[model samples]
Target: MDALQGFGELGLGSRLKRISEHLMKEGQLIYDHFEIDFDPYLFPVFKLISQKDGITNTEIFNAVGLTQPAVTQSIHKLTKKGLIELIDDDSDKRRKIIHLSPKGKTLLKQLQPIWKSIDSVIKSFGMETSSSLISHLNSFEHKLKTHSFSKSVIKSLGNRHHSIQISTFQNSEAEKTAFYDLNEEWLRTFFYVEPFDEEVLSNPDKYIIDKGGHIFFTKLNGEIVGTVALMPLPKQNTFELTKMAVSPKHRGQKIGQQLMQYCLDFAKNLGLPNLILYSSRKLENAIYIYRKYGFVEIPVEPDCHYKRCDIKMEIVF
Candidate 1:
């Protein structure tokens, strides 16, 4: 076992790092052979900026799988190298957009064939290894987002307890407040709220109800105890289950399950192909309920809006 030891059972980080370093080393050689002054590690960020021009630094970070600081550093390096520039958005004075410079565009033109060659090699690597390496990496990252390694270790440590009823989100401002309150309570308790959370929770009527999504609330004696949202995707009979929240004090009452059942039934009645959801592994009881309803894991969509989403699951008819 020692002779054939791999990252020692749970060394996903180490394994990934080693794999990235190996590829980067080979990639650097390719760059050197071509005398391209660009670092291969910086390529993803550059390419992301090119593809998502006028996007914020944080957007580039999310799209390219890098930390905010790392992305910022790369941006600075590119700025210095005359490959890109950061311009502030006019309407939003605080927003800065990332744009590729003409030099960068020209460089990419020169490197296009080299990129094709690397692409071919990557495709061959997938065939030789009998794995879709890039896709699997994406799926792995998505799974990690759904559940952190730390929570995965400790979720089943103790028993869970809660119970509660379901109500649909009417246009009433009171229900609107409750929806925000329930979801915000859960987010603040388990994870800090991201900008996307703020946007959705702040304006469910505008972003959800008006857009044809449904919000269901769990009730206890006519009091809104929990809430779940069903967001319809454009041009598809698909719905994304999102913004589920049961008040912290009311968790053990199993309100979440009841809400989930109602949500599922709602989708099923709509005759949709499936219902999709984004959640983390840390929410053990929730995931259990989802899986109980036959929610199997699937790869997350690349253009997913939420940074908090790590796992994509579906309940197909």
Candidate 2:
């Protein structure tokens, strides 16, 4: 008899329950080495608070999809352990602001290397498979947020660039030509508009050299296929992500996501609180990538360069 028939005869629901218990035990054994409590829900609480510090209890409850009492109990436990603290809102005495304590911050900082090590171990099987998995997970998260859940229907267009390099622009004509040539094709496909003046295309190198911002380019076999510019915004404790473009032939290869991850990792290493980017509505793929990387849409300001651009996104590091 088939396994299903056997299970049906032996109470499939009970067998599945036992299997779940066995998996939980295995998971616990795997996590015991890290000395982590291994409550999957707790990390989400910490992440939510890290993203929006001083959030209210009710807001946490809603965001985490936990009942009010469950959230209250978790908060109580975390507070008692000195992982988090509650601060009273000055304007509204009734509202208590929840935030991570110094110990919690230290714990999070310490967990970074451990998480990265675990990630590397998990992704060591195959580079292409690992990249595809990460991209699919990001796309799934984006779709879930937009209430557009679908199965793994992502199609890969065969043209994929394997190697990507990051570097500051060199003050050479060849480098300038490569930058502009990449951006020219990118703008045409990404924005679907007529190309900008040749001056602006050539100005990134000079602008970065003058403004003290870093220019990183993605090169595939000596050809520039993607580019991103990170510059300081006028506001205090904020940085701007600018000129993120990828070549048309390399669209679905998750190059844009990798570039954004690089920018975010750079910002975090610099200890910046937030990073901002201005994007247009027409570029849905770019917008989706931004959102996948935890960028929340915010109100646009009048001074934004692209008048047709109506979307602004910000992410707290």
Candidate 3:
């Protein structure tokens, strides 16, 4: 039992502080997982600045309800970290305007989805009915303990990414070209397109679709942004997950991972026994994601069908 809970109303302030610290630590872990260099404690000030391009220190202090000196110190730290810049106010030379630096803007782009996930998870914790402040805190803490806050946030992000619709491969001319072009884009980037790759990509319907296989694509606002396919293997009731690619413009949005999940679900619905994939170890991020999705590495045959493949992985349903 927490001693702070024993103090009841008398320890309200300490209780709130303890909760705040716990949340801040979790927030920091989330940022670190995304490889973002940000302090969760500085969020209020930074978020306020992000809202208003040319905000003033006085305005930040007033809006966040922080002491003037604390707000000033936050602005100082942000400036020192190169996340925000202080510029002379055009109307008043004595006053300074705060703006996010270019690096900060880039970071914000990376952080928006993460913030959405955090907001979603926190809002979910508020759904329980509680009679009093302390009771509410207890319920919230219980929920946090029951479900990992960080994992919840990450799962929320996956759901957000799924908002981009994934559809089965339609035999439309445009979609056919998309399937070919998307695969070619990645192949040319990481490895040369061998004759086998050209023939397979050029004729997905013949090589994959007609051979008792399936293809899936993710569309963003009616534009096909990503795709993956499952080709039937010679072994009965097994398929090779292959040709996964996301448009370069949409690479960072987890479209690839979303496609992987969609294919897994499709395979499960079909009652397939297992899914196999051949990938190169040089693609570290893709390899890691495959492993995360429960794909175990297997020995690659010396005469692997695809010359570019150095690693093979499989997941049993």
Candidate 4:
């Protein structure tokens, strides 16, 4: 039998259908309230233009996976509505730069309150529930992108319950030392290049104390099994997710996804608008997580210390 029939046999089809309908209605309500002609295509286009000003129409089409004419049509409508404007590129006369018009900015400003209302509704449900939904969405997105792993792996991972925990690291020596010792081998084996420094390992308290970065660990018992670090970026409203390492024995357990969810929630709680990360294709699992979390690959900057890293991912909140 097909998937739908199987789900019906399991008595879950009706529930699943209800969920789908609820989500569809909720999405439509959001778009309607914003007074913007909402389509699946428009959200990404708006996100791209809002974040990367002066983007060309061709670039927007490519980035958002839309046909040139379709994008142009949408742009024309938005322009007529006074939400966007096309300007001639000084460097390349052949290309026209797309930007949010003053009216677009005003709409965005107006929509901010609506977005916050939606967010508040979600938050009212509680942090754990919101975090769980975000985690599931991120996982689904990652699976679609990488096309890695087999059906068996997916099934096994799906059966497990993943959770995130956030806490401030106590400025205590023993706790810090213990975390370092437990994670040392996992870090060494997974991140052979640019392994956690001995100094940092020897003094976790000092590292967090002096550096002011939050240390988040993932535990599957009394033992710490995975970790991710959020360090301050040079500029305000941004942070770097670093030192994300999961124990080899727990590789397929979806521990990495949980850790990433924790980091994302941490950033969101701080009201930061963006989070940046550096990773290598060597760790396919990690790259998949980054992409699953709405991160897009960007040009790598020079003077990056990790020689193995050739990819950089950034997510704008």
Q: Estimate the TM-score of every prediction.
A: 0.48, 0.47, 0.53, 0.46
Comparing 3 with 4 on TM-score, the higher-scoring candidate is 3
Expressed as tens digits, the lDDT of each residue in 104-208 for candidate 4 is 664565454445554554343333332444344334333323532223223322443344343556655645655666556654544443444555566655654
Ranking by lDDT: 3, 1, 2, 4
lDDT of 2 by residue, 1-317 (tens): 33532444345555445534543453343333233333434656777887775899989988999788888878886776566879999999999999987656655664554445434432431233324433443343333344311111111112334667766677678767766777666555334433333455678655555766766778778877788778656554466787776665554355666777888898899888888988877554456567877999999987776655789999986
Ranking by TM-score: 3, 1, 2, 4
RMSD of each: 17.9, 18.6, 9.7, 19.2
TM-score of 1: 0.48
Displacement of residue 243 (Cα, Å) in model 2 is: 1.1
Candidate 1: global Cα-lDDT? 0.70
Please write out the lDDT profile of model 3 over residues 37-150, one tens digit for every residue. Answer: 578888999999999969998889889999988898888878866679789988999999999986567667878888988998999987898898888888887887788898
**Clashes within 3 Å, all models in order:** 13, 0, 0, 0
- How far off is residue 279 in model 2, in Å? 0.8
- Whichever of 1 and 3 has more TM-score, that candidate is 3
Error of 2 at 45 (Å): 45
- Model 1 segments beyond 4 Å from truth? 1-164, 235-237
The CA root-mean-square deviation of candidate 1, after full C-alpha superposition on the true structure, stands at: 17.9
